[model samples]
Target chain A: MARTADVDDLVARARKGEPRAVARLITLIENASPQLREVMAALNPLAGRARVIGLTGAPGVGKSTSTNALVRAFRRQDLRVGVLAVDPSSPFTGGALLGDRVRMQDHASDAGVFIRSMASRGHLGGLAWAAPQAIRVLDAAGCDVVLVETVGVGQAEVEIASLADSTIVLVSPGMGDSIQAAKAGILEIADVFVVNKADRDGAQQTVRDLRNMIALAAPEGWKPPIVPTVAVKDEGVADVVQKLDEHLAWMEDSGELNRRRRARARDEIEAIAVTALRERMGDLHGHQRLDVLAEKVLDGSCDPYAAADELVEGLTESG
Target chain B: MARTADVDDLVARARKGEPRAVARLITLIENASPQLREVMAALNPLAGRARVIGLTGAPGVGKSTSTNALVRAFRRQDLRVGVLAVDPSSPFTGGALLGDRVRMQDHASDAGVFIRSMASRGHLGGLAWAAPQAIRVLDAAGCDVVLVETVGVGQAEVEIASLADSTIVLVSPGMGDSIQAAKAGILEIADVFVVNKADRDGAQQTVRDLRNMIALAAPEGWKPPIVPTVAVKDEGVADVVQKLDEHLAWMEDSGELNRRRRARARDEIEAIAVTALRERMGDLHGHQRLDVLAEKVLDGSCDPYAAADELVEGLTESG
Candidate 1:
């Protein structure tokens, strides 16, 4: 009862906009704590309130700088903001992520702004799998807008798009050409494209390239808008915000918002189920059955698929 | 019986170093055909013969060029070689990968050389999950050496390591500091470090920085050798090959090879089992049970954990 009361208390404080409680809850999620089930149960009803906007780009594309500028801009409008800086490349939550946390000290004193850096290093399914849960904690904690800032390298950009209501893909001049961006797979996921560091050389060309690619791709619904911004100077961020609002409105009117959220919920549920099963499977491995099968596989006595069948059957029978 | 004979004929041809048969078997793997179970069972006995070498680095770090040079080196000794250019970032098998294949035309005419490109875009567990089986195909087909070249951005580098007997982490001058490499989680995984593009500026600094980081990391067992190379020019490639052989010899002498192989087998079996369960889980979702549970969670009537529990229960009962 005391532990249950503690989870209830934590959720209550988080709902009241206490940053420490919000931080504690996210830490719980990050650590994959035993009490997570109770905490999620307590917080689930209070979630689904915040608008999640994901900002993603390759490293050195000014993702964090852009996020910092966007946070300041949102604070100007008096909106409560939560920033989840997810680094999928790092296996642990330290080093460079801590540096980002330090750089974000500009918002440290603002009670309306909560910033957290998560590293996906040791996580089973990586940070993308755990990020939806972190987002829920931030959402339940009364943030009006949650900015999920992730390094949009390769698969991570796609995963972030799935988590956010509106995804902003940042590209810098000299990073690569439009074909390179296409190869990186960022072209398909951008709801809003920010040509960050617009003051740099070839910024205009970057914008042109994006426009040409957008025309070529010609997505079925809700064509993505490109916004140019020198984020450090705070130039054109308001337009970025305005475009986000427009995208959100379009999504709402077009029923895309509802559909996206439904898909998110479905993914979240499946990820949770798979994780639970994976943990169970880990236990099965500990029982030496997997090792026995692995030995057989190594010796070529059985194929992996056949060995897998035996393991799955054993799991089902045990269950 | 004809289908079985067809599979038998294919395996027999592949065992005789027939390129088309090897290519067909890999195609079957990439497509995840139903006959894979039979193919794997047949291949399993013939695998565990090749020395698997994984080469990974950030894009533009000359992973493919290095792989190409190394393949040429391996072929000089009259060793049958298999090259798997795995693009975890790309979802499809064409475009850039095909371009790489074209660049590797030097090996196209060689009957002893088999080269294939795999994109992890639509793969269930990504290419890393599928790569082991593909490696087995090459291994069974009688490759004395199998080189896996993957872009080492984030988690893909780690996944490639699990599938490799010797993992070579490539870095280029001006790519970043050793700290950046460390942040990328490459420091811990490198068995041999290749300072690629050694003709470029800051090449020595890159090597020095890596030395510093490796000194600080101070990994137990084998110390990774840093080889400087301009892979395009085929410079220092022989040293890389020598290092690979040394690492392989060290592994065998120290029993690390057996341990690594056993671990690989364990991971492969678990991945297969997980994939099978995940596919079944997909089937469960099609029954509207997951959608219904997702809806309940969306409406705040239930949390994901409870819904996952219920789904797991249902799955077990149905099984």
Candidate 2:
């Protein structure tokens, strides 16, 4: 746990774009230290300034390569960038694979870039609870744009959408990658689609498949555009960046950006309250009141709903 | 919303092994009907009688095929079986794919087998909230065994483990399937591992990799055994069943089964309570209380934690 004074100093330094301070603040959030409330209090005013772009795709889709390319592109425009690559695989293992670190080292020498890998870590609310705070840290540290890259598997992609202002869903040609993306419900969360490995055969077909699916199922306001890119060779990378900028512009023009940030803030508040309540409930566990109620439900004297009602009542009355 | 009398009739019929009644009860749970309390009340006494086996693996690992084989194996013992194949893909579309339905038709004519596919549906609590109730319905409907099959992607697999007495994680040889499983944190939840497509090349290698990983892991008191099976050929499946039975026996003898069920009940009760709170909060949204608090947080007048404290206080005071 960090002391309040030290945390305040770290926040001040992070505001000045000190990498060590920024990393320390994120570590504090991840550990759920006693000083978290103070840190968030200090950092709250500095947040909501950076554009959060979420990049996601299935394994073997070159998401890391594309992320590196995007960082280089953003740097070329003289914009500071932050990357939060969430490793869904490293939760239980406690260590990330070597591949991502090696791929991201291209920007290691640049002071304008900050890269962090977040493991799922089995937190109470999962990554959804933690990523927002991390994004806030980067946003406060003066990154013009933050890229949250995650493996496009199941719930993670959806959670990423909630945290990102713009989401890019990447797919490569062949091996049923596009179909897998569709099945994973990637179509709903993607604001921009990228078909990487454009040198491969069927890249056009992959793009066509995405376009057709988008046309068939897209919502009323926006249509996701598919961009072809060979991320390794940096071909068509500029177009991807241009599309992202346009999407963000559209969001701002339509007032969707404010709505999204408000929703994000709302979710964060709710998650905090729920976590606090759960902690209260945990403190009540093994006590006489909850034990008796649980026993009743177990013995069929009451249904779980009724038991839950009683528990909630107990919490309120005790409060 | 269903009427109380109708819900009671459905519960009564479900207990008598009427398939339509069972299906109707499950539908009510899925839809979260107003009469759900009554149905759960009536079914509470009849639950805790079925063994829940969670089967999961990545796509193309032949999860459905293996589930079908397990259903057949259980039927040969003259035991009634219920299957809930959770379709993560079908939630947004509001319709389940025909693949699972077509595969499970082998037991369509058998009176003792019941299979239902559950779409993810983008529900408030996702599968974690709905699966327990569906399992209860099956338990009350007189299933000696229930199988919950889900795509072993990301968080869904972990959620399934919480609802089952035992979990079997299936993997096919090659395609880096085993590595993907490891990355997804499947090792923590797996009580038994089945290497499907045992006749394929690298079947032994997949088995070896799983064994090495399990050996390195192997949480205290139990070692997860790896079984190789060719589900299409119905080879080595009986051994899989035998392993499942052995695991259940071990859990019972060590009193782990009771502990797991108690934990499940606790989670179910907590989920219901939290959901109730969330619904109440949702109702308060756009109203002066929550909206004002949100504004304060957004404008940096207050931190999120403090706002959360106030919101929870308002909820308690109103209650």
- Against the native complex, each candidate's DockQ, computed on alpha carbons, is 0.76, 0.59
Candidate 2 lDDT by residue in tens digits, A232-318 = 999999999999989988999999888888788878888887777766765675455556666676677878889779878877886
Give TM-score, chain B, model 2: 0.94
Which ranges of candidate 2 are over 4 A from the true structure?
Answer: A97-100, A175-179, A285-292, B88-94, B177-179, B285-288
lDDT of 1 by residue, B110-134 (tens): 8888888877766776765689999
Q: In model 1, which residue pairs have backbone atoms overlapping below 3 Å?
A: A91-A121, B57-B152, B91-B121
Candidate 2, residues B154-198, lDDT tens digits: the string is 778888899899999998898585566677888999999999999
Candidate 1 structure quality by residue, lDDT tens digits, A229-272: 99999999999999999999999999999888878887787778
* Candidate 1 global CA lDDT score: 0.85
Complex DockQ, candidate 1: 0.76
Error of 1 at B256 (Å): 1.9
Error at A101, model 1, angstroms: 3.5
| C-alpha TM-scores of all predictions | 0.97, 0.96
